[model samples]
Structure formats: C-alpha cells, structure tokens
Target: MHAHGGTRSGDAVPGDEELLARLRAAPVLAGPLPEFDPAAAPDSPGPLFAAWLTDALEAGVPEPQTMTLSTADADGEPSARVLILRGIDSADCAFVFASDARARKGRDLAANARAALTWYWPAHGRQIRMAGPVTALGEDAVRRDFLGRSEAARAAAFTGTVSEPLTGTQEYDRAFRAARALVAAEPDRVPDTHTVYRLRAREAEFFQGRADPFHTRVRYVREGRAWTRTLLWP
Candidate 1:
C-alpha cells in the first residue's frame, strides 16, 4: 500500500517535520584525490579489494560483502537486487548467490553476460563498483556450496520461486511441506534451482570518503587480458 498520501502516479514529498534532528553528522569528502597513488594501490583489483575489505571489517562495517547485482533482460529491461558475495577469486573475480531455473536474473545472465555489482558501506564512507561479463559455474561447484548451507537455510531456499507472485499463506505452506518432505527423502541431493554465477569483472571502481574535502576514486579497466588503472576526477 502507498503511504504518506502518495498516489499511483504522483507522491507527496516529505517536509521539514519528517527530517531527523541530529546533533552531529558524519563529514563527506570532496575535492581531489589524496596523496595515495592508485597505480601503487595493488597489483590487481582483487588484492586491492581484499585490503580495503579488511579495513572495512576492522572498522566494523556490517555485511561488507553485501552488494547489489544488476542485470538486464533480452529486451533491455533492467532489474537489480541485493545478493551476498559468496566468494572472491584470486583474479579479483567474485561470485553471488542465485537460482538458475527461477528465471529473471538467471535468464538475463544466460542471454547477456554483461552485469554490474555495487558495494557500499555508508558508515565507513566506502564504495566499490564492479562491472563485467558473468559466467555460470559447474553443477558440482553449485552443489558443493549448497550442501554446505545449514538445513534450515537449504529448506528456506526451496520455499519460494524467485520473482514469482505468491498466492497466499496456504499455498506457501503446502509448498514448504512438499519441499521439506523431498529434502527428507533425499538429503544428499542439492536443489536443482540453487545456483551461483561468477562475475568476471572487466572494470572496477573504488571510492573512499574522508573527513576532508578530498575524496578518492580509482578506476580499473581491463584491456584485452590486461588491466589498466587510472584515477578519476571525484
């Protein structure tokens, strides 16, 4: 249901009363890049990302690997959803949780390998964006990961068809019962719908915000098989 008296085609904007009153707010960085050199950051985007990720964890950013996965259908209709970063390769590539037979994003990936992932930790004022072609991993790899999940999680995974409309609680309960029975019968088998897509990045951009006005943005682009790094104007 729409809230704040918003209409289907139009919505009322919140006024000053809706704004929160805080004594202090975190500062945002501006201006130019700091003394740090992007070229010397790391040999590859993956290692550089690892270093930054470590810092974020040390700083206590929640779910640092949680990123937004963006994909587009064959007709160019775009869709994006948040997905946990399941794994990262030595080559700076990453994998995300998904389902193959559930359609939507999976179908889009099958047709178009191009996709993007964005990770932002507002509390730490850090953001990482990666874009590239995606590749579906082997069934063995998917099964291995699926089997590693807790039984509850595996059961939950089987409860719903992604991006599909739900009828009601009764329908869901029936499906849940069926899924539980199937799993009970064959606990060794991984659900065919559970899959993972590894995103092989062709480009990556890192942003770091500081108290000072000088923010940093480093962009890395792949040329053929080699990566070329550059500093962008923030």
Candidate 2:
C-alpha cells in the first residue's frame, strides 16, 4: 500500500520505511510495574549517583562524565552547553571546568548562581538531572588545576581568545602565540578568564529506562537546609 504523503506519481518516499521501522521498534508499556523500592535506594542522592556512575563505567559507556549544564542570565536569557563533570562531593553536587569571566555561561553564573546539569547515558538508558547554586573556585584552585594540565592543554588556556568569533586559521595561530607569550612572561599569574565553578545541588532526579512500560524516577529535594528523597511516577 502507498504510504501517507505519497506523490501523485505513486513513488514511495525515501525515508518512510526507516521511519516506520523506528516507530514499530519503539518500547511499549503494557505490563506490571517494575519492583523499585524507594527505601532500597541510597538515602542520599550523591551516593546513588556514584553507584549509577559506576554502572555506566562498567558498562563501557563513552564519556561517562559528559553532562549538559544549563544556566541563565539575570535578564532571564537561558543558555546551555555541554561541559565535563570534574568532581563531586557530599557537600556540593558537581564541579565543571569553566572560566568565570570568559564566556556567556560564566557571566550568567556570576549574575545568577542557579544552574542545572543533565547527564544522559544512552547505552545504559539512564539519565540524571541536577539543579543547584554555583560557586566559583578561588585562584589557588584554578592554578593547581592548571599546573596539573599538560603543556599543550595549558597552552590552549593561554590563548586568551575565548567565545570570540574567529575568521581563519592564521588569526587563531596569531592569538595563540600572543597568549603563550603572556604566559611565558608571568607563569604564576592566573588568567582572569580561567576559573572553575562548582554546583551545590539542592535537588536531583535519577531516571532509569526499562524495557517494560513503567520507567523509574526518583527525586531528591532540599528542604529547610536538609535533603528529602521521594519517588515519582514516570
């Protein structure tokens, strides 16, 4: 039979079969709910995140620490970009590498401390969402991290041009050379553009995709300076 939106000439569409196959393969939810006991989940979201992160690593998911960071300006202009998850702590939620004074995201964070992070592991069909206030690291911390980086990586940071429009390769090289010269003259000087921001999570949600119809979602919220965990229907 001819597909929908068929041409008058009765020629089959190019992508119709592929689209139909994908639709047919979509998961169907028509069974009893999976056994997910909230009491069995980790009392704290941080530990639960750690456990799931380990699973992602063991499963060989690529770039397990890759996450999307969402931020907004004081004027309410929303911005989002992918950033590497550097660290996590019980006191704070997660750390991401960024220059406080360099990019739009950094400017937004300075204006508004609130931020959100989303980590998705498609291979394992799992996702984690985190929201919290951001705090910038001191100069000492930035220097320590900078020193740990390889010379090549450090050189990249010295290239002062960040988030600026670029025209050609020659211009990029020229900028890189200027940045390197600045670094060479004063190695101890911390570039104003190099800074790290840590997210102190006030709320987080973990999602586990299942072959069955009922997926699992657990949420943790901070209340009165304490975190409370609850389960939500997916």
Candidate 3:
C-alpha cells in the first residue's frame, strides 16, 4: 500500500496516493453561499465579519464561532488547534480567546507574540482569516472570564497543566472533582495562570466560495486608524 514503492517497517501501509484519492472524492463546499460583492463590502473587515457571522447564525451553522488558532514556538515551529471564539471587538480591532498560561500555547506565545486565527463556515462556503501580534489581557479580565465558566471548565482551568502526561483518567477525575469542590466553596478561585489573549489583527481576509473555481477573496490591511482593502485572485 506504500505509494512510494518502498517498504514501511514491516507490512506496507496505505500511502499518499490512496489518501489523496479519498480527499479528492470528498465533497467541496456543498452548501449555498450568499453573493459576495467585493466592492460593496465594508471598508473594514470587522463589519464584514459581523455581517457574515450574523448570516451564519441565522442559517444555523453549527459552532459558527469556532475557529482554528495557530501559534508558533520561539524556534518557529508552528502548531494549531480548535478553540471557540470568545468575542470579536471591532472597536478594539482584536479577536479574543482564553487559554491556560501554563499550557504549551501559552509558552509559545510568551516566546512569540504573534499568531493567526481562522474561521470556516462550510455550511455557507465562507471563511475568515486574521493574523497579527498578540496581547495578554489584564488580570481583571482573565478573572471574569474564568469565573464565568461552568464548574467543570473552572475545575479544568484551575488545573492548567494540559500537555503533561497523566497517570490515567482516574487520576484526572479525582483531581477534577477535588478542584470542583474547592471552586464550589470559593467561586472566585481564578487561577493565576488563566489568561485571555487578544490578537490585534494587522490584517484580515474574507473568503467567499463560488460555483466556479474562481472564488472571491478580499483582504483588509490595517493602516493606523484606517484600513486598506485589496481583492485577490482566486
């Protein structure tokens, strides 16, 4: 099954060609997307993002606010994972999400203060991309965000060591229950490591899929108090 015609360890395993074929056969943007007029789009990406988000909400796109956060280590190695979009403030020109400051991503951000976020609503054939420098929000904001979480989330946040190896699920369950009980007694038990980081976007892009291969893409680059827009070829 190895496409390279080379043996892999012992028995051959399915290789690149099979996976490529499967990927090619999968559906490509099967949903209806609203018409996109690049020229008519708002000058700033914030308003456009808000409008698309509204449409996605009305269309019942599941987890419309879920986005992929990409960050890199000091050495430039990159990693990405899914996270819920906590908020988007057009006035501040930032996208917000929370993380445990003790986690690997937190360490990565400490070494490098820039990251990227991407949101894909396949149900509407739309995507939003933002990349820029990061800023750790104030402690007061972090405390509020942590206390607002559910008991389970608060418990998990209380124990921010996610990447470390655990003895077993039982170990975690025991710790989680203990933390939950402690939090129940004191609702303001926000961990010192809990943080809400904001990505102040240097640029943002909006992508709208089309029937033809040539889709639509508009990029907004920040220019101090103003923004410059550019249309990219699909």
Off by over 4 Å in 1: 1-39
lDDT of 3 at 111: 95
Task: Report lDDT (CA) for all predictions.
Answer: 0.76, 0.77, 0.87
> After superposing candidate 2, which stretches have Cα over 4 Å from the reference?
1-37, 91-96, 181-189
User: Candidates' TM-scores?
Assistant: 0.82, 0.80, 0.90
lDDT of 1: 0.76
How do the residues 1-234 of candidate 1 rate in per-residue lDDT, one tens digit apiece? 576755556655455655333313424433232245665787568777787778778877798868899999888999998887888884654555556557688888887878999988766667889898888788887988788877766776788786789999998888888878777777877877777888888899988776564668898888876778888888
Off by over 4 Å in 3: 1-20
What's the residue-level lDDT of 173 in candidate 1? 87
Worst 10 residues of 3 by lDDT: 155-164
Better of 1 and 2 by lDDT: 2
Candidate 3: residue 127 Cα off by (Å): 1.2
Best candidate, TM-score: 3
Q: Is candidate 1 or candidate 3 better by TM-score?
A: 3
Winner on lDDT between 2 and 3 is: 3
Ranking by TM-score: 3, 1, 2
In model 1, which range of ten residues has the least summed lDDT? 22-31
